[model samples]
Target chain A: MDHKILQTARELIEEAGYPALTVDQVAVRAGVGKAAIYRRYASKAEMAFAATMHGQWPPPLTDAGSLYEDLLALARAFHVRMATPTARQVAPALISELAGNPDLDAQFQNTFLAAEHAALAEIIERAVGRGELAGPIDPTIAHLLLLGSLAAGLYIINLTVDDTMITELATAAAAGIAALADRHHSGNPQGATQPQ
Target chain B: MDHKILQTARELIEEAGYPALTVDQVAVRAGVGKAAIYRRYASKAEMAFAATMHGQWPPPLTDAGSLYEDLLALARAFHVRMATPTARQVAPALISELAGNPDLDAQFQNTFLAAEHAALAEIIERAVGRGELAGPIDPTIAHLLLLGSLAAGLYIINLTVDDTMITELATAAAAGIAALADRHHSGNPQGATQPQ
Candidate 1:
């Protein structure tokens, strides 16, 4: 079944790494014919993408009615995703491997990065609609600020991202976005927080 | 002699990555005996660490007398270090390799992460002294915000980190820090900017 193959693939990725994941090995583990897998996916990249999409993808965020709460939701969701054993094991390797494998890179961007960007963009748009933000903020930059801070704490510094850290990061990010929107909308820094 | 060995090691890392870099290859490229490299460094990781330290370390930041300017200097400095061809080539691999390699992780923390943390800490301390900040802010959180934003912009998005982005990130970080400190000092959000 499709579910069995995806589950088996996820286990293989968690146990070894993406480089060690192969179609034959996955088929053998899943007790499915290699032909069945090939029928579903064109390559290892596609299979891994499908497995990841099915297994560990974060659910889409709903608006929390406040920019701070909305950013917190997204940040917490990202933390949950990155904190997965599979994600922790696979992500660094995937990033390294992506340099040489353009196909994998494109697949990751299309499936993961693009979706993440869209979700964050929606959050920012909702904030703007509620007049919490001055106007549409650059979601890419917003994404960088929110997720980037979490990445540094989790990946670079090897810190445990507890509730306190998440709250602080989310609050600061919301403040930063507000300040940026203020600066962008009005050239003068003083007019940043005033009514439009 | 030492310079040549380090240069060769850097070239190897840039060309074929750290796994392919061996002391023997470094000696051959640098026209030094294998024993010479062994005499200088006990392991390939040590040699790579030294080469990175000698080659592309960011300069220590002097206070520019303002939090915004100081952070901008640090952020810009970080951008320059990351933008190097060798850094672009080796960083992702290095991050992946660090998980399995304790010695490399230690060296990275001691030499690079610690120094960057100290520099940002100094900037925050200076800001406090000038009353630009209410009091000392958490340097770890501050460093995460600044470098995290840069890393996201550079590594993940694969976007060029221009001066504008750097400035905005720095300003937002400063504001974030102020907001955090205010929240820490006073439970209420309204008193954050009013007093300091």
Candidate 2:
């Protein structure tokens, strides 16, 4: 029953858009009563966010050994999730909506952004443990390089981050992180790559 | 006259939002006739895009000698433009609106994206000529790294891309580009930094 409502919501979002979606329309199409939807979701925005992002939460973190492979895995997972009709069409509009509403933005940061940040922290930690990264690079900055670039490529230019693009992006990001860590430790550019 | 109209439009967008902004309100505020606005802009979207982006268009690119300095200059310029009240508030919603409209998206690509791309191409060419890069890296990819990440950082998290952030990002991006070029030249990772 819950699956049916969520799927119906996804269909409506794909057909129309995040802005056009409403509780009434969702209730009607899902063949469920308004009470049913309200019981499941607090508001139209919540419903829309869930329908677009339900199964894709926590961002599919991987235990891949190296920073490059780990970032690649995360990037690929992000691409797969974002390439969905629902996510691609809905996310930009949803994010735009977030600009006006502080409550919604907080909700988003708490739910989606928090999870993704946690996943990234774990990846960075694993990389440090393996000596692949000299120490922890800023997770927020790291997140920007890896996932932020992928999101921008898709949202801004409609350019899909393909395997080649992903490989290049992940490699560059890993290299960038290494360089940053090196700079932080020694303060000299020349000593960036030497053994600690 | 055009400046007054654009400023009024920007103020309306900042106060209410992209959707709530009307040509009527802009005219009243600017103390100009409706005909005056229509003469300058085709529609409300155009006016808003222009008002939010009038002087910032063609993205201030610089030839600061090396790729790292050049990229840092570009990054700082982008930060200044996007950090404005109007651009920060309006851009996300405007981009969201672009999803449903093809002609508007094309206009955006032609007006903003194209100029930015051309500027980046010039920068990449300079890097190649100076032997800072082995060969030209993908301009689209480079744009994503330098500008896209900055956009995401601001739009998503409201985190301003400060000097510290820009410095770290520029360093990483430069390293990333070099690593990519090296990989392209020779398959071996060790050969990435050797004199060409």
Candidate 3:
């Protein structure tokens, strides 16, 4: 029953686009009562996310034995997930809704973004453990770079995210993050203190 | 009359958000007929952009005598423009619409994005002339880093784009682009040819 509703929702979004989707249509098409649909999902945004995005989120981070390789794996996974026909179609609508709807935004942050952050945190931790980094650096800029660059390429410039492009972007982001971490550590005398 | 219409459009978007804005409302609020509004602007999206973004774009790109300084200036200008209340409210809607609407998307690419690309080209040209870079690097990566990072920070992470943050982002982007350019040149023997 849940699967049927989600699949129906996905089809509707793919066919008519997200802005045109509604609970009434989903209820009718899925052959479920409105009460049943509402029982499972609180709103159209929630249902849309569940159907389009919630299934394959955070995209599995693996230990590739090096910072660059790890980042490459992460980038490759992200690109694959983002490049899907369903994801591409729904992204703009979801992003726009996220900007305006605080409840849905919070849900996304807590569930989707939080999981991705945890995955990244593990990768960064591994890098630190491997002596690749001096210490844990803030991942904010790195996160922005990876997600932002991919979004820009996919949505704005219509650039195809091929393997070569993904590798180059991952390389740039890895280098940028390392440089930033190096600069931050070196710039502050207090933070620069190392055990003798 | 144009000023009144634009001002009214800006007010409506800011007050009610972009999703709720209508051409009819703008016409009524501005004390003009629908035909008058249509005469000046072809669509609601066009009117919204004119009210919010068209006024202060592509943001001035000043040559600060060096690649880092120039990038910093550009980043700063972009941050200021994007941080405005009007811009913040309208951006998600505009971006969402751009994805779905071909005419508006084409106009945006031809006018706004084209201007930004031209400005960035000049910066890269000056960097090359100054011997700061080997050759022209694809601005695609650099552009993604700049604009994508900013959008992510603003819309997703709710980051505060301060001077220090802006400087760090610029520094990272400059270093990243330089490294990519260096690699591209060194890797390509044909492109690496220099006039004796």
Candidate 4:
């Protein structure tokens, strides 16, 4: 029942701006009573966070021995996540909310930011442990590069409901990120740190 | 004179959204007569496109010997260009307009889209000429990854507005792109194109 409410809330927010969502509207959409929502979330922040995490943040990248392979897969998954029409309708509002709300900001930092960094970090640790990457490369910097590419791929269609371009964007990003990881693994003087 | 009006119009739009800008407001901003704006841009699109180009596309990347070096310079230039706080305020509205207006979209394609691609292509050409990249890496794909990372970096910072994080984000993107390009140059056979 709570899961149904969350999905309904996400749909309402996705259709209307985040600022415009009402618990009443969410309940109506979910076909549940308002009390059900209050039981779960005290305020819109919790509701929106639930909705956003539901909407954003594709799952973690598994640690395939080939870091490039893993990173590329993550990119593909990221694109698939964004391919939803709701992503287009709500992206602008999401940007505004993320920019303005400290609570949401912290939530994002904890959930999306930390998760993304962790996935990339896992790949790096594996590579470094196996002597795949050079000593000079920093995992933090590598994670930033890989995750940055994935994030960029998300907005390629930007607010356009049309997602036909996502596959190309994802494929390119995954390949590019993977290629970089592979090169760094092959003893490049500098890996995705400061351009050669 | 008309060109000057169009340019001024964009600044006005950036300062105040398109809905807010009046012919008189544009004239005042541009230091031109209202008739001049009327003379050139029958509507807002004519004017907004020019102002956006001011920062949308910086000058093209001149061929520096190596793709990495050329892109480093280009990426940094882009960082400074989008760093304008005002761009964030105005970008979404303009992008929103793109969906509704074909003329504006074409202008965007010509100005912002074409210039970035042209510049990236130049870098790729240099790499190919130098035999730095292997037989064939789709230039379009390479272009998207590089631009996507750069775009994503700015969009994330702008949306998140975490001023402290930009430098690291920018650095990571540049490094990642360089690594990606290097792999394109080297051509790895273990590439995973599509996943089941």
Best by TM-score: 2
Residue B184 displacement (Å), model 1: 1.2
Candidates 1 and 3 compared by TM-score, better number? 3
Residue A96 miss distance in model 4 (angstroms): 4.4
TM-score result, candidate 1: 0.84
Off by over 4 Å in 1: A13-24, A32-56, A187-196, B11-23, B32-56, B187-196
Q: lDDT tens digits, residues A30-90, model 4?
A: 8888887877665665676566654456575667655445655665575566545444334
Candidate 2 lDDT, tens digit per residue, A79-99?
877767667667777767777
CA error at residue A127 for candidate 1, angstroms: 1.4
Looking at every candidate separately, what fraction of the true A–B Cα contacts under 8 Å does it contain?
0.47, 0.62, 0.42, 0.24
Ranking by DockQ: 2, 1, 3, 4
Report the Cα interface RMSD of each model, rounded to 1 decimal.
4.4, 4.3, 6.6, 5.4
Q: Which candidate number maximizes DockQ?
A: 2
Using DockQ as the measure, name the better of candidate 3 and candidate 4. 3
State in Å the error of residue A177, model 3: 0.3
Q: Can you write out model 3's per-residue Cα lDDT over A84-193, one digit (the tens) per residue? A: 75666567667667777777778778887777777777777787787776666666666776666777666555556788777667766766666666667666532211
**Residue B28 in model 3: lDDT:** 88
Residue pairs that clash (backbone atoms under 3 angstroms), model 4: A192-B175, B133-B185, B134-B185
Model 2 residue runs over 4 Å out of place are A1-4, A14-20, A31-46, A187-196, B1-4, B11-20, B29-45, B54-56, B187-196
